[model samples]
Target: MSEQTGKQMSKEEKDARFEAELLPVLDPLYNFAYRLTLDEDDANDLVQETYLKAYRFFDYFEQGTNAKAWLFRILKNSFINEFRKKSKQPAKVDYSEVEGYYNTEDVEGESGVATTTDMRTESVQDLIGDEVASALNALPVDFRTVIILCDLEGFTYEEMAKILDIPIGTVRSRLHRARNSLKEKLEKYAKSMGYNGE
Candidate 1:
C-alpha cells in the first residue's frame, strides 16, 4: 500500500510492527555500523540514529518485505550523512601519532630509516586478516559500501543495487573493481608475508 493512501496506523500498531520487524535486524545493523565506523561508540550512535529515522518514517515502509535490507539502507544513508558532517569539522591530532614520534626519535636516528626486525617470514593467513581489513577499509566509500553489502552482508546484486540506489550494472562494475583492488592489496601483503600463490 502507498504510504499516504493507507489508513494511518495507531501508535501501538507502529510500535508492534517496529518491534516485530526492525528490532530483529539490530545485530546486523550494528555489525554494518561498526565496520563503517570502526569505533564502538560511533557504531552505537549510528545504529541509534538509524533506528530513530526508521521509526519516524516507518509508515512508508512496506510490510512483509526485506526488513533487514530496509534497515540497512537506512543505516547506510545515516552513516554517509554522519561521515560527511564529520569530514567538514576540523581535523584532530591523534595522541598515538605524538607518542609514536617520540618513541621513534628516542630509538632510531631522526634522519635515517628506522630499522626493525622483519616479520616477513610470517604466514600470509596470520597477516592477511589485518591486511585484508586495511585494504577493505582503504576502499572508496561507494566501492566499500558495495563490498560490505554484497560480500559481508550476503546481499544479492539486485538487493545491493536497491540498497545503494545505483543501477545494477553499476553495482556489478563497482564490485568487480573493488574486488580486484582488494585482491591486489592482499597479494602484495601475501608476497611480503612469504606466500608464493600456493
Candidate 2:
C-alpha cells in the first residue's frame, strides 16, 4: 500500500493527526452537542468524550476523506451512545400532527370571503437573529439537531446523512420538518413579544 494509504498510523502519528484535525472542529461539534444536550456543561463533556474516542480510533479514519464528516460521525455516535440513554427524550412530533392541526382550522376558499380568524398576521422573519436562536433552542432535540447541522452549520444532506448515520432521504425530510417547526415556533414567540409588524 502507498505510504499515504497504508495501514493505520502509529500512536504518535494518530495523536498528532487527530490533534491537527479534530481540535479545530470542537466549536462546531460543541454547537451540535449543545443543540442536542441543551446544557453547556453536558455539551463540554460530550465534546471532550467525543474527541477522546476519535483520538483512540484515529487509525480507522481514511486519509484524504472528509474529515469533518468523519469527526461529526464520531461526535454524533458518542452523543447517541452515551448521552441519549440518559436523556430519554421523545422524538419530535411528526408532520402529521402539524397537518392535522392545520386541517382542523377552517379557512376561506378561493372566493376569499370571511373565515376563521387568521391570527397568523405576523411573520417570524421579523424576529431578530438572537431571538430566532433562542427559539431554535426551544425546539425538540431531534429538530434542533437537524436545524443546527443543516441550516446553521451549512452541512449538506450527504454529510448530514453520514454524520447522523441515516439515509439522505431521512435527512431531507427531517430538515424540512425541522425548519417548519422552527418557523412556527419563532412566529409564536414573535407574536408573544407583541411584534405586530412593527
Candidate 3:
C-alpha cells in the first residue's frame, strides 16, 4: 500500500507494526551509529533522531519489506546531515581537560605518550581486533561506510546501493576501493607486527 493508504492504519496497529519490525533491529542500528560517530553520546543521539524520523514518516514505509534497510537509510542520511552541520561550525575545545592533563605528573616530554601499562601484547585476539578497528576507522567516511554496510552488516550490494542512495555500480567501485584501502592499512600493521605475509 502507498503511504497515503498506509496512513489510514489505526494508531494501535501502527504502533504494533513498528514495535515488531523496527525495534528488533535496535542493536544493529546502535552498532552502525557507534561506528559512524565513534562517540557513545553522539551515537545514541543519532539513533534517537533516526527513530523519531522513522516513526514520524512510518507511513512511507512499506510493510513486508526490509525494515532494517529502511531504518539504515534513515540513519545514514541523519548522520550525513549531522556531519555536514557540524562541519560548518568551528571546533570546540575543553581547556580544563587539557590543563588537567598537563598538570598531571604523568606528563612526559614533547611526545604525547602516557606512561600507562603496555597493552600492545596483552591479548593477541584483542590486539588484532583493535588494529582492525583502527584500520577501518582510519578510512574516509564514504569508504568506511561502504565497508560497514557490505562487509560488517552483510547487506547485499543492491541493498547497500539503496541505503547509500548511490548507483549499484558506484557501490561496487566504492566497496572495491574501500577494501583495498583497508588492506593496505592492515598490511602495514601486520608488517610492523613481524608478519611479512611469508
lDDT of 1 by residue, 36-97 (tens): 77668878989999999999989889999999999998888887777557645456333334
Q: Which residue pairs show backbone clashes in model 1?
A: none
Best by TM-score: 3
Better of 1 and 3 by TM-score: 3
Question: Which stretches of model 3 miss by more than 4 angstroms?
Answer: 1-7, 86-121
| Candidate 2 weakest lDDT stretch, 10 residues | 107-116
Estimate the TM-score of every prediction.
0.75, 0.71, 0.80
Candidate 2 stretches greater than 4 Å from native: 1-6, 87-127, 192-198
Query: Which of the two, 1 or 2, has more lDDT?
Result: 1
lDDT of each: 0.75, 0.71, 0.80
> How many Å off is the CA of 172 in candidate 1?
0.5
Model 3 clashing residue pairs (backbone)? none
Ranking by TM-score: 3, 1, 2
In candidate 2, position 18 carries an lDDT of 76
